[model samples]
Target: MARIISLEDVLKDQIKEINQLEMVTSFIQNKEELKDSLIQAQNDIEDLSIGVLGLKKDLEKMKEHNVSQRKLMALYQQLDDRIIHMTNNFPESLTQQLDRQEEKLNPIIKEKTPNSYKKPLAIVTNSDLTKCEPIITGDSIVKDCRKMLFKDPEDSYIIKELSDSEFSKIPKYMIGRQTLSTVNAFITTINQIMKFKYGILALGKVGARKKGELNLYLEFKKEESDLKAANQEGEIYFFNADDYERETNSKLDKTKLNLLTVLRHCKRIHEIRLGKNVKYRVITS
Candidate 1:
């Protein structure tokens, strides 16, 4: 009976050892599979990294191929700038030459002219503006200091020809009821603006309506010979082609030139001496 019991205990011990060994073998196999999966994931990440690098290189090459287009765009910008420089003050070609002289007409003979302009620098109360009351627009109205050194009253009449007040019976923009003081002030203002701002550049002489002549005319045509004519009172400036285009809403063309000619002859057209070369610049706001 003792022998039988001992043998049974030995058999139970053997069975327990076998079960433990089986568990250990299963755990080891699972760990090996996990290691294999980790290795495969690392390989996939490296392959994906290589593909991304290749795509980046292709994009860089595409950008490099656009060099000519980039250069062309730069060239277009420069050409546009040159166009503005040339046409900024004289955007439109001239219908009448600058040297073309008209027969001296008194007060521009209300017959051939239209009424007052929409935004005139100066206005006259009647047909014979030289003898009648004139109204002008501006901040300052007196040419107390810089008298435009004009050569002839006829050329000065060319400046005075800008006003044609007989168009409308009523004054459109003038205020103060045409009183004595108001009329004088308006005349002063027009003369000042023309002499200082709107007048053209002249070497030896600047043309403006002289004092007490009872004529109308400051025009953008100033005496270039003496820019300090007025002893520095008004604002004088130059504008780039871009700004001129923006203000006028057109490129430099024949139509645009007519508008510019009117402005230059009446207001201020741009002509400057740049390094010994005479060039036109946009000198108005």
Candidate 2:
């Protein structure tokens, strides 16, 4: 028995079949693209995560190496001192042998130790740096002065003066612009919290300041709050020797926060408020 199929019904049926086929084809194509994209994105994210993990591991290693280097430097100094003392008490040949050993150890020490931590250092400016030598030690830490240069044989570093064009090169962490009251409040809070000695102040291009001359300062305080509480009435000023002793004796507990990292964070804040690099004269005072 042949079922009678009208032309209208046949046309409708064909149209429906074609539409369904088109939709299914489109879906299949989209699904393939989506799957490929998902796979690619997953791979990219995994690679980025691995890179971040590697960077973290490297940073940890660097920090450990820095600590070890500091200790090694102390040991080296002690050994040198002992050799000098023995020169007065022991034979000349023994002193010679010690000197030879020290010479042999120099390259290994330089290679293993960070160049930033060296000695006979100074922050020589263009005028002062006629014969520039790297400031390898803790010399600049004492002065906190500008026109500063530090030399380390391990790192070939240069600091340009703050001119209109070169000012950008000055680390963001090095520059601060803050109100005087705000600055004072911060200082008070820090002193109260940590009971550090006097703070060190240098002229940065910007900072929270009351006057023009009050632009820059660094805080040097005792590490232990208990000790600070004990010496509440006493003035807090540290000389180079005092700082050295405090550091060596483990009394000066300070962490050297990476200045660059802080600066990047501040820049983000500035961008949020000011919408990026609005070159305003940072009134330091």
Candidate 3:
């Protein structure tokens, strides 16, 4: 009989095949683990991008809120200024009444002052206003002063009629309630007599039961005519169309004449001259 192979050699051959197969299976398992890790990383990156976009939107909303808050703050400042101005010299009850009255009437009135105005260098004393006379028509002053003060065309009228001697006799001029100043220094100088007394530029019916009229007036002094032409005191001023528009913040359809018509007839003036003592100037805020 032939010689048989040893059992140890057969056993060694089978073990070698088994070890090779195990190595191949291990390699396949490691590759699958690496692939899973890569997929998880990609998902994390996508989630991070979504979170960043959400944060950007929230930042924009915050910015818009800040802007609105700033605007409201500005409005509050304006209201504060008005309150301070109103409280300056008024009694508490009177102030409250005035506030209520203004609230009720401001809307009904047109958004304009008178179309014309005069600027006084000084308030004429009631005693002196009686002897003094405004030789030139307030209308003329309004036109010239408008050019000198505003350097532009305007729509306005002067309350020239009130400057007449008859009106000066009224108690308003004697009181210090409604005196006004001019926009031009030169005009003030020329009309310095008006500076010594109180004058009214506006008057209207007032009171519910008594129905007495309300008047506005101011005190002026002739000696103070040396002040700058553009310096204004109270509501009265030497104004042109431009000055009226600027001071009152109003618009006019036409240059309203007939300002002097409101005055009682007096000796017709032959000529009027604005002396060099007064100087007209442009008004600036």
Candidate 4:
């Protein structure tokens, strides 16, 4: 007797294995379906958010146009009323003629009147900022600004003084122009741009002789809010230079530090020598 196998018992074991396999297959199918559903749901949410924003803009435009229509209608009605008032003293026949003309004019006016004074416009168009300007980001500008101002990002931030030539380098970074006049305006503009784009006061120039410097000192801070000085010797101060008729009121010295002041600081270089592209037979030495 070799365990006395029965057909009914063997059939029962096989049925149980088949049921387990079916369950595993169903589970895998459900997992993939769930993933697809999640992706679809995420896309639907983004679409809905964009639609809601578009609806808000359209509402504003509708309101503005409606108000404009009301204004035009009011003006037309006022003119009609004025004409009627003037003709009150005239003959009844003439006044009746004016009334009839007014009735005819009202329909024509309504047809000719524009909802807005400007050209007919469609509803507010969608403008998605993320879809455009992949280049004008903080990551790129910060490095350029840091490199231009400090030369080295990790270097000390204590650039206490800058001559007129040194100060002139800031305008192109701020407004992308080299025609800005006065050192006072240059620093102010650069700080304004930095504040809006970077959300911090990046630089400050102080020209107070009563305290210390006769020229503008380029004080770069990490943030808009006041921060502790990086070192004990570095103390920040301010004064009104216009009232002081002394050295502080005098303009920053235009003396450039080096011969490279006139150079536009281009990145690419072009140079050639007669030594190159020449062939000579070597004589035995």
Candidate 5:
């Protein structure tokens, strides 16, 4: 076995060693490339995670903004409703104030007007009239007159004079004082007068040359319609008893047709007093 050494054999052994070294070097280079690829993949994953986090935060902000917008819209709606309510009610409030001021100045106005120019007026009260009929027919006559007046409109001047004449027939003391009994009696008398004096013309069934005299009747009819409409819509319609009496040439007692009794009987009616003036309304459901 420890035989003769050959130079060719030694050279072949040296060449095998060189091939093995080359294989080791190739394996090291491959290991380094694989490590670099792993590091790059880790960095990419981290970047993706950061991007996802940012998107989540943005989504949260957008949700908050949407909620804020909804709240703002609700506030705007409330403001709009308030404005509409004010607009609708302002004119009536102003008119009431003006009427009060006029009442305060009435004595001065009467004094200024000459006695000769002032016409002799017939002042009547609801209490002064007697009820001859059990049923009140004035309601139907009022409605009919309104329809007729609207059918053929007349001059404002003539209408004003007629209205003034009717109002003058009511006494100053009894203008605001009304009782249910008195009102009923007054209505009965009015119905009787309309039927006996005017006949078919009382309900405006026939045309007349004095159409302007029906202006007050038309106004009352309109008011009744307005009250009915308001009640249907679940709203309240109110008026001052004194102002109503003056306009309609009627009187009422303190107990019978008083605001409280009317409210109790009608169910829809409500009462409130501002100073001396009593305000009534048929409330909404």
Candidate 6:
């Protein structure tokens, strides 16, 4: 268009070229922004891959820890089973050894312990009489029997010779106050002789007294009379130190002869004190 193109046409052509150049510059800028977007997306994908690998490594470690725990549980179960088996099947020799050990320790333990055996009882028998002399002599039997009766004057018994019908025929009061005494005295005499011969102190003083002698006849005269009536006929047979000396036929000191001491050794007699006088009694039964 060197052949003198119109001015309007030239201006139009220049405007079209400027529009194309502006479009080209815009496309170049858009291409550079797209390249930067692609680089950022690649970096994000690489970081995601690294995080997945770390998660896989942690899962493997957890699996290994679970296996170790299972192994430990199995070991504990095996140990418990072994302990149960050992307890249930213990050897007999071990049990015998334990019993022997206990027996060995028993004597040592007993050495420090107190005696617990039962005390032997004193049993008097006919065999014992055969070995010992009679405590009461035949001469002293009557005196000893009288002493026993005086001590418990109120106690009286019916004669075995008298039948129940015969005893009943007599008045009850008369039987108790009159006839009973003679029967009692007779029975007591026989019993005393047997006790002396057998060497048995069955009715004698069982234990010692604190006082040598004490007033025993505390009953009134009327009471004594009633007791005498209940046990004896007519007058009561009262004995003293003189009577005992006469009966025993031993001239030993009368004061030294404590009736209680004699009663302790004797099988048939007891003593009571009435005012200043000493009375003796026989033990029946």
For each of the candidates, give the backbone clash count: 20, 25, 40, 0, 11, 9
Identify the superior model by TM-score, candidate 2 or candidate 5.
5
Give the TM-score (vs. native) of candidate 5: 0.24
Candidate 2 on 77-110: residue-level lDDT in tens? Answer: 9999999997688988888999999988875542
Q: On residues 1-285, what C-alpha lDDT tens digit does candidate 3 reach at each position? A: 998989999899889988988887787868788788889999999999999999999999999999999999999999999899877856889878988999988777544343234343433345534443334675552222323333221112222222434545545433233322321222332233222112232221222112221322211222224333435453323323333333346642322222211121222111111343322222211
Q: Regarding TM-score, does 2 or 6 come out ahead?
A: 6
Which lDDT tens digits does candidate 5 get at residues 1-285? 788869999899998998998988887879888788889999999999999999999999999999999999999999999999988878887889998999888745433311122222323345423322234475652122322223221111011111334434545454456544544454344334323222222344112223444654454445546556544344233444543455456765554354345333444345655456455553432
Q: Can you give the lDDT of residue 241 in candidate 6?
A: 50
lDDT of 1: 0.44
lDDT of 6 by residue, 78-169 (tens): 99999999989999999999999998987654331112222234344555444443356665622223323233222321112334444456
lDDT of each: 0.44, 0.43, 0.42, 0.40, 0.50, 0.49
Summing lDDT over every window of 10 consecutive residues in candidate 4, give the lowest-scoring window: 276-285
How close to the true structure is residue 186 of candidate 3, measured as C-alpha lDDT?
22
The candidate maximizing lDDT is 5
Give the poorly placed runs of model 6, Cα more than 4 Å off.
1-28, 92-285
Per-residue alpha-carbon lDDT of model 1 for 1-285, expressed as tens digits?
565568889999999999999988887879888788889999999999999999999988888878878998999999999989877767243625432434333335543112121222332233333343233448644332112222222224222222434222323333213343433343343344344333322211213222221222222233332343534334344322333444446555654444344435434445554344332333322
Ordered from best to worst lDDT, the candidate numbers read 5, 6, 1, 2, 3, 4
TM-scores of all predicted structures: 0.21, 0.22, 0.24, 0.22, 0.24, 0.24
Q: How well does candidate 4 match the true structure in TM-score terms?
A: 0.22
Model 6 root-mean-square deviation: 36.2
lDDT score for candidate 6 against the true structure: 0.49
Q: Give the per-residue lDDT digits (tens) of candidate 4, residues 1-285.
A: 579989999999999999999998888879888889999999999999999999999999999999999999999999999999887767889878999999888765433221122322222223322222233565563212322222321122111223566546544544243342433343343233322222112222221222243232222232111223323123222211121223234532332111112221321111111233211111110
